[model samples]
Target: MSHQPLIDGFEFATAGARQKGRWPVRELPRLRDMLASDAGEIAYELEGTRDERGRPGLRLSLQGTLELRCQRCLEPMPFEVGADEVLVLAASQAEIDAEPADAHAPDRVLAGKEMPVRDLIEDQLILELPYAPRHEGCAAGAGQRADERISPFAGLRGLMRGKH
Candidate 1:
C-alpha cells in the first residue's frame, strides 16, 4: 500500500491478516547508512499468525537488492538480500524482557495498536545485509597481493649479518 498503515498486532493475528507491499530504498533512513546508493526497491509480505507455542506473531518475508561498497576494492557492488523472520508479540517491553533468551525461539517484540509497517519491513531488510560486502574476484586478488608484498624489515637482516 502507498499509504503507511498502523497494524494492531493482537487484532491482526486474531484475524489472520496478510499484506504485501514495496518501498523505495531511499525511504528507509536506517538502511541508508549501509547502502552505497539508494536506487532500488524492497518487496515485502507480512502475515499474522499464532506460532506453535500459541504466541501471536508476525511472519515477514522480504527480497531486495542493495548497492553496497566492496570492502576489498572500495567499489560499488550489488548485494542481493532475502530474509524471513517470525516476531512473537508481547503486551509490553517488560514482557519481552522477562522471557528467557532461547536460541530456538522466535524473537519477541512489544505489540502495539499503531505499529508502523514500514519500520518493521526496514528492520528485517537491514538484518539481511552482509556485515562486510566484497566482490569475489577482487577479494582473491587483494589476498594474493598481500602475500607477495616484501616486508620493510628485509634490509635489517643484511645489517645484522655485518654485510651493510
Candidate 2:
C-alpha cells in the first residue's frame, strides 16, 4: 500500500479542508500492540475547522473492529473501536503548555508544518481501547471453571472447617 499522506495543520485549518481514508491496523504502532490479530482496517475522517470559540481545530472520527485478547478468557475478542475528538490547534509547544488541562475542554495540540495523519488517528484509537477488554457472555469455562480449577487455599479451608 502507498504511504498515507501528511498534512500541514496550519494550512489545512486555514483552507478548511476535509479528508477521509482507511489505515491498515498493522501500521499503527501503539494500536497494533493491543491487537490479537493486526489484520483489519481503521476508517478515519478529519475536518479542519474553527471551533465555536473561534479556535483553529481539527475534528477527527475513527471507526474499526479490533481483535483483542479478552483479559478474563484469554481468547480473541472482537472489540469495536469508535472515537471522535476535537483538537484545538496551538502554534507552538509553549501555547499548548499554557492551556489548562480541563476534562471538559477539547484537547489542544501544537500545529506543525507536517502532521502525520496516521499518527493522529492512531492516538485516538489507543485512547478508545479498553484497559482490560472482555467479551460479553464469553464461552463457559473460559475463565476458571469450578470443576477444573484448584483452589490455592483449599487445605486451609478444610483445616478451618475442622474437616482435616
Candidate 3:
C-alpha cells in the first residue's frame, strides 16, 4: 500500500491556515478495503502550521462510518467513529524526539518533504480503535450468562473443602 500525498512540499508559518477537505478512503491503505466493503466516506479537518523549528504540526479531526465486525458477536456492525488527533511532522525521528515532551507526539515523519494524508488518516484510525470493541446493548445478558455458567466450586473450591 502506497501513501497518498496530502501536503506537497509546503511549509506553514506561525500564522498558517487550516486545511479542510474530504479525502477518499481508497487512497489510504488500511482504509481502502474497509471503506469499500462498508461503502462510506471518511472526512477530515486538518489544522496546522510550521513551528519555530520548522516542524509541521497539525490537529486532525476525523469523522466517518465504518462497517466492521463485532468482536463479540462476529456480526457486521456499522460504527460511526469520530477522533481528534494531534501530529507533528518532522524531518527525522531524532528531530521529533527532540521536541518538548509537552508537545504532541508525531504519528509520522515527513522525511522526504511530503505529508501524505492517507498515511495520516491510517494512523488516526488506528489510534482511535477501541481496546474492546463491542456493539451496544449486547453485553449485559452475555456477561451475566457466562458468570452464571461458571461453577463457584468447580475446581480449587472442592480441594479446599475436602481438606477442611
Candidate 4:
C-alpha cells in the first residue's frame, strides 16, 4: 500500500554495497500536493543501484518517469530521466573524505544516519526538471507558419537586388 516499499530491499549496511534493483512507483496526486501542484496519475518504474560505501554512504542511479505540464502548450509531458546520483550519508565532511573516492562520489553529502529514498527521489526530480517543457511539435508548427506568413529578411533581399 505504501510507496516506500520501492526501497524496501535496499541494504544500508555498508557504503559500498551494490543495490541494483527495480521497483514500481506510482505518483499519486497527493505526492504532488506537497509540491503545491496538481497532477494526474503517474506510473513508472525506478531501476538503478545504490553503491554503498563502508557504513551508510550510497551512490544511487536515479532513473524514472515524471508526468508534468509542458511549459509551452500546458499539456501533459512525461519525462524520463536517468541520473547517476551519489549521496554521501556521512555525519560530517571528515567522514565523507575518509571514504574511498570512486565513480560514485556524491554530489551532495547527507548529515544524517539514514538515507530516505523518498527524500532522494524528491531531490532527483527537482534536479532533473527542465526550465521549459514543450511538446515535440509545439514550436515547429508555430515557426513554420510564421515563416510562411512573412519572408525572413525581405527588406534585406530588396536592398541586395538593388545593389546588384
State each model's CA lDDT, in order: 0.73, 0.73, 0.54, 0.45
Model 3 C-alpha lDDT per residue in residues 60-157, reported as the tens digit of each score: 78998776665577666676789875454555556544545431333434434565666666766654554344566565326523333334433332
Clash counts for all predictions = 0, 0, 0, 5
Query: TM per model?
Result: 0.80, 0.79, 0.63, 0.50
- In model 1, the runs with Cα more than 4 Å from the true position are 1-4, 139-141, 144-164
Worst 10 residues of 4 by lDDT: 155-164
In the range 65-152, model 1's lDDT, one tens digit per residue, is 8898887778889988788888778886667656665556676666889888887887667656665667767754445344333445
* Alpha carbon deviation, residue 108, candidate 1 (Å): 1.4
Residue 162 CA displacement from its true place in model 1, Å: 65
Give candidate 4 regions above 4 Å deviation. 1-15, 18-56, 93-106, 139-164
Number of clashes found in candidate 3: 0
Instruction: Rate residue 90 of model 2 by lDDT.
Output: 80
Tens-digit lDDT string for candidate 4 (1-34): 2334334223442423444434334443233533
Highest-scoring model, TM-score:
1
Candidate 1 weakest ten by summed lDDT: 155-164
Ranking by TM-score: 1, 2, 3, 4
RMSD of each: 14.8, 13.9, 13.8, 15.6
Please, what are the lDDT tens digits per residue for candidate 2 over residues 43-122? 88888888889988888988889999876778998888788878778887666556554446677766878888976787
Residue 82 in model 2: lDDT: 80
